[model samples]
Target: MPENRTEISELGEFGLIERLNQDVILRNPSTLKGIGDDAAVIEAGDHVKVVTTDLLIEGVHFDLSYAPLTHVGFKAVAVNVSDIAAMNAIPTQITVSIALSNRFSVEAVEDLYAGINAACEHYGVDLVGGDTTASRGGLVISVTAIGEAQKDQVSYRSGAKVNDILCVTGDLGSALIGLQILEREKQVYLANPDMKPDLEKYDVVTGRQLKPDARMDIIHELREMDIVPTSMMDVSDGLASEIFHICKASNVGALIYEDKLPIDKQTFDTAVELNLDPITCVLNGGEDYELLFTIDQKDFAKLEKHPDIHFIGHMTKAEEGKFLVTKSGTAVQLKAQGWKHF
Candidate 1:
């Protein structure tokens, strides 16, 4: 190893972000937030604007062998929208940029745009503009989403107080399980060209991986019920990992119950079939795209009756430490093995 060189794996994704952020200078008064959150908050008169972007690269972020171009395009936009939703904001517009090689045809580009347009329609966000460029490599897509929220309505990752109820939207682990299934099928197809991909029974799990829906409906519901989360983020990097983020940002601790973790029947059964611990999948698998949030104890009842929301735990004092109480009455320190770009 060279004296001044270090591997990116040593720093990891969050570590790299932390190191990069050390040199950042937030000079503009209008730049309410620069980093360390799901989206950047900017001053926009009565309502603040939240902006977030995500890039998807072929082979790295996706495998085009099994992943349809359409799903890839839609997912590219959905992930960015998920970030805005994490901030308790409403998505209004998006700009898409794509780079492709000669291997892709005009029709292939159209298919990608079809899914992008569908997501735009579903989310009610306008596709205002984008850029098209040539790439020597595989397909690349970058989407930037802009959303709106009242200055007071926005939820920051650092706002959770001790004793706030921890909640998550939708079930977990299905996406990772789905990815596993997809990869398995890809291997099978590669080994035998005559064999067709077996994807019929795993539609639910597969769809969770391919076309995840951002929790915008819940955001709208929260607005209607006049409930703003004290702290919130999307479950893109697994449940336990996100809990650690909330704890670190809010300067608090957390205690989540094993039984309280939400796992879909299909996701659970498939994990078992794949010889994976379902609970482990729920804890460490990434890309669920569900909302993880904290609510004031007093505001819990306002959202208690919602069918999709699951109350998993509550915040604790900083000195107590973050832990997960097992179903067998064992209290263990929580671990974070979330998605690491490095």
Candidate 2:
């Protein structure tokens, strides 16, 4: 009585997107892009409009038990804004939709909106409009962000050229380390409800996990400096995974240096405490939300002195192969073990 049913896990998220993209037919001339890139591009007069969407489910994308609704709201907006920035566009508006069950009170919803409103103000984006509905399950939030930029200002994953300087913003691995600490504390709390979590010392790592700020500041700085990244993407997955994406998209290879990888002191310390290799955490950790971009070799001098940005390596010819040059002067092939829900 049952038909053949394939589990979504079998195909994976990217696989599903690839399959769906095959059936998509772009009809409108104004529609410059569909799926595949960080955001969809649309021709709009002198500039192009970039649109991106993300859906967050309670249990799958987040654990409501540990994740505060306020932080959840901020993260939801920051993630969407990150995509817009990846396209080298300035976010102008966002529409947020939420489906709630009776378990959440109106006051709780207000707390969530407080974060959303704060993010909107921080990013200078208007909360245009969205829909709300009753859900039998836990909270579900969907956000769509719209941004704009000049035709020439847009950066895509496919724009990296051989010999371009690979750059990363801020640090990596903090968020993943923070998650581990939170989970550990949560387990402790569950075992004995009276124990208060000593979270004061881990504020930096915890903040990275909760209220991640999108690097629109860097985007604005690039504009001010008159520099456009040859290629760009946000580090949602991990450094290694994101580098692989840029390489695959631009038909190039990369050679990163282990010593050049950026890991915060708190992240390194916490990772050591949790028995995770700090470098491994930097390479494979997820949700750092930093910008990973490539710049022309000539433009490197301009950004060389930037305190927050790190110059890890250079883009290489596809046949050169992706490699990580260790601190001891040994080279090893790079592997991407990004976050996988399935």
Instruction: Identify the leading candidate in terms of lDDT.
Output: 1
Tens-digit lDDT track of model 2 for 49-115: 9999999999877777788888899889999999999999999999999999999999999988998
TM-score of each: 0.98, 0.98
Candidate 1 residue-wise lDDT, 129-216, digit = tens: 9999999999989999999999999999999999999999999999999999999999998999899997888999999999999999
Model 1, poorest ten-residue lDDT window? 1-10
Q: Locate the minimum summed-lDDT window of 10 residues in model 2.
A: 59-68
RMSD (CA, Å), candidate 1 to true, equals: 1.2
Clashing pairs in 2: none
Count the clashes in each prediction. 0, 0
RMSD of 2: 1.1
Reference-based lDDT, each prediction: 0.94, 0.93
